[model samples]
Target: MVETADLTNHFLIAMPQLTDPNFSQTVTYICEHSREGALGIVINRPLDLRLREILAHMDLEADDAAVAELPVYLGGPVQTDRGFIVHPGTERWESTMEVTDGISVTSSRDILGAIARGRGPQRMLVALGYAGWASGQLEREIAENAWLSGPADPEILFELPHGARWSAAAARLGVDLTLISGQAGHG
Candidate 1:
């Protein structure tokens, strides 16, 4: 049997027809994928909440005005109260996992404390919750034409405006989302 390709460091762009409010038109960055399951963060769903507010809620004061104002993303519907952070893979943190050569996801409170004190990763995207798929579930979804999978680009992941990530991620695969039909009937 051919081994299925692993999709770590990839993006899952919701298909145009995927109207589920939680995932509609979103680009999710895959952090880890295995036979057991998958974990990802929605890169384009910035909530009204900001990092500074989260810090204050945690009883930490912001040491840098700019970092505090950074937008916090609604990573996904799972574990909505938890926090997750995506940043350049740099420095050792209490709970940091290097998802790619230059990308890391930190979930420990120390990293957040560091961020509040202006000592966190220079570039980071704060998020709450994460998208998850049970074993074989994500593969099935892709096979069902619910998403477009492509290599995750850091520029689109961390640099672009939140609203641009959806199309930008799909563009990396040379697939124009606008051209994809919203109707989902097999020909």
Candidate 2:
């Protein structure tokens, strides 16, 4: 039997053929992956909401002038009301998952409090929700050509403009997504 490698710290780029409204033309950063299942956060697809709005809603005080305008992303389709913070740092938060040596995901409000105090991770993306898959589900989707996996680039996640993330992630594999057909082909 062939061993399946874990995809932790990888990026999953949606193929053009993927018409799922939740994931079409999106780039997802895999924070955890195992034989049991997988969990990731979409790096693109910002909603109309802003970080300030969320802060206000949660009654968490923040540096309003600095973070108010920051775009809040729609991480994925699952648990849309929950918040997730993908950031770079080793500092442990209340409910944090160390995704890689330099990156992590925090789901607790304490991190938000730290962020509000301007003491959080240097680079971070605040998002709501996350993508998830059952055992064997992601592997099957990859086999079906629904997504292309590649190494995760922190620059793409934290530095690039949100609209460019999808193509940028695909470009990492030398793929020009625009030229790809939406129809599936079998050899």
Candidate 3:
């Protein structure tokens, strides 16, 4: 059984059998979950795009002098033009979704500006694009063993190194992810 409404702020760890190139070894943070569908950001993959580049393209300024360094992550394949930032919960900007207890996702340009100005949330991950599933879609995948869902930790979403996030997140569930076989069949 799946906990649908409570999926928001949780992490979905891709099962080894998820052959979709886009989701292999992925750790996604659920940003929204409603009857409309589910939306998330992939936390484990980093792309060549940088936060500075994204901000510049959005016509936002990055005050290198005041702003701390930023890291860009590969959110997902959907809406590559759009950007999403996962951060610690804060009230400075709007357009945020509580992804977990202490984590939030911000897409407003104002938040980007604040980050550039060094007034942003204490922790964050800037990502372009996001993973989405239509109503009943994600649930179907999970039932097929395409993913393992679990609660998310603030550190796992915002602080763990990108390459290690998948494994780390799986470990939180007491599962040895490497042992998960990708071959799928009806049990």
Candidate 4:
């Protein structure tokens, strides 16, 4: 059966055994999930690219140096050419989609322009591409203990350092991934 359970605004913590190079040790924030499929941005994988570099490429200059210095993340393996911004805001933008009450994902250049002008939301994660799962693919992965799902924590997503996110996310659900064996027991 396809999962009807909405994972919007949830965090999928990769289990210790989930050695997929794309998702292992990552904390993915689910932005949209439906009967058809799911889309998410991996929160903890920082790409070497900086926002300043992206801005320069787009010919958008930032008013604030720190904002320009923000790290751009490797969101996932899909659509690596695109950019996505995850932020907490209620304002609608040209391509903004509300993942929850205050959480949103915007791909429009307008938002990036605002960010460049120091008018963007205070907290944001800029990522390239996103994690996607075909219908029932995530459910099957969960059933196989490839991931642990729990409420998404804004602080973990926006405030914490990238290296700390995985354990911190799993700890929110009281799981110590290191304590779990990578090899599963066969019945």
Task: Supply the global lDDT for candidate 4.
Answer: 0.93
Model 4: per-residue Cα lDDT at residue 24: 89
lDDT of 1 by residue, 1-187 (tens): 2234698999999999899999999999999999988999999999999898999998998888999899999999999999999999667688889998799999999998888888888888899999999888898888878988988899998899999899989888999999988765887
C-alpha lDDT values of all predictions: 0.90, 0.90, 0.82, 0.93
Error of 4 at 18 (Å): 0.9
Q: Which stretches of candidate 3 lie over 4 Å from their true place?
A: 1-5, 64-69, 184-187
Which 10 residues in a row give candidate 4 its minimum summed lDDT? 1-10
lDDT of 2 by residue, 43-159 (tens): 999999888888888797677566767889999999999999999989999999999889999999998888888888767899999999988899989988899999999999999
**Which residue pairs does candidate 3 place in steric collision?**
9-99, 17-182
What lDDT does candidate 4 reach at residue 138? Answer: 92
lDDT of 3 at 54: 75
Candidate 4: list runs displaced more than 4 Å.
2-4, 185-187
Candidate 2 has an lDDT of 0.90
Candidate 3 accuracy as TM-score: 0.88
TM-score of each: 0.94, 0.94, 0.88, 0.96
